[model samples]
Target: MSTRTPLDVFLSDQALAEAREQAKIPGTLAIAITPAAPGTQCSWCDCDIALNETEHRCKGCPNPAAVIMHQFRHGSPVRVDVPLCTGCHPDAARFVLALAQAGGTR
Candidate 1:
């Protein structure tokens, strides 16, 4: 659980930077955020994230890059906003894109 509120994460400087870098590029997989006091591990990967908190929350950043990733995962449309941290945000974007381009044969 993150000690920072949605607003706090929304106004973070570092978080904004990370989001800007990927803002132009679309992403599907959104990693739920997990806040740590100082050296806590990321919920989806290895990184502190520090002030880059909003990167994990769709509501936090309100970026189009954030998505439900899969409707079947929960069977609902209201869950479209999935939080993601800076560490995993970029990697997940690249990964999902690869899968799509590779065409796993749906």
Candidate 2:
């Protein structure tokens, strides 16, 4: 029996839930980071990052709040690293690199 835990998910920074879920890969996450100091919930698994835990983020795309407060105001896309826990960061980064190597954005 496979029991899934909260730590076993990964979400992308796509602007919409549909886009986020298009990957539809098992063992991934899709929750928004909210209600914490600068968004505390992990972007991938939505797990609360303990004070002692390490966190990481990937290159971010424009989201509404960020567009209004940052990229738009800055006249360019701002650096937006969606908060992710250490556990999820490596796989997400590897996937991104793989995509870049593919030479065509899907």
Candidate 3:
């Protein structure tokens, strides 16, 4: 015994269709697969650094776009690397810490 209004039935069918469509699409549908390459400058300050010495820095504290993309891909958070010299790492770290403490909305 089941009772479903027309709207409910329509929504259920729509959802099922959408799910099937999504299932048929490749996992990396909208994502670009870039070859691994070293960055040349800080993502924030554009400071030059050794390509091999670059560090992974989230684009933003609690990067919302990364979070959303990661969840959509059903994978771990996306990390973006940028070249930051040893002299700049401490300043960058401090900025990140401050952003974190300020609720990371920025």
Cα lDDT listed for each candidate: 0.40, 0.35, 0.37
Clashing pairs in 1: 31-83, 56-83, 56-84
Sequence-dependent TM-score of model 2: 0.30
- Backbone clash total for model 2 is 4
Pairs of colliding residues, candidate 3: none
By summed lDDT, the worst window of 10 consecutive residues in model 2 runs over 64-73
Predicted structure 1, TM vs. truth:
0.28
lDDT of 3 by residue, 1-106 (tens): 1354677557645654454444344442122111112333333453445668668454433211111110112132333343344444456556655654675422
Q: After superposing candidate 1, which stretches have Cα over 4 Å from the reference?
A: 1-83
Give the TM-score of each candidate.
0.28, 0.30, 0.30
Give candidate 1's error at residue 37 in angstroms: 17
Model 3 per-residue lDDT at 5: 67
In candidate 3, where is summed lDDT lowest over 10 consecutive residues? 63-72
Tell me the tens digit of each residue's lDDT in model 2 across 1-106: 1332343322222333443443254332322332123334454443445656666443342221211110111222223344445555555556545654674232
Two-way lDDT contest, 1 vs 3, winner: 1
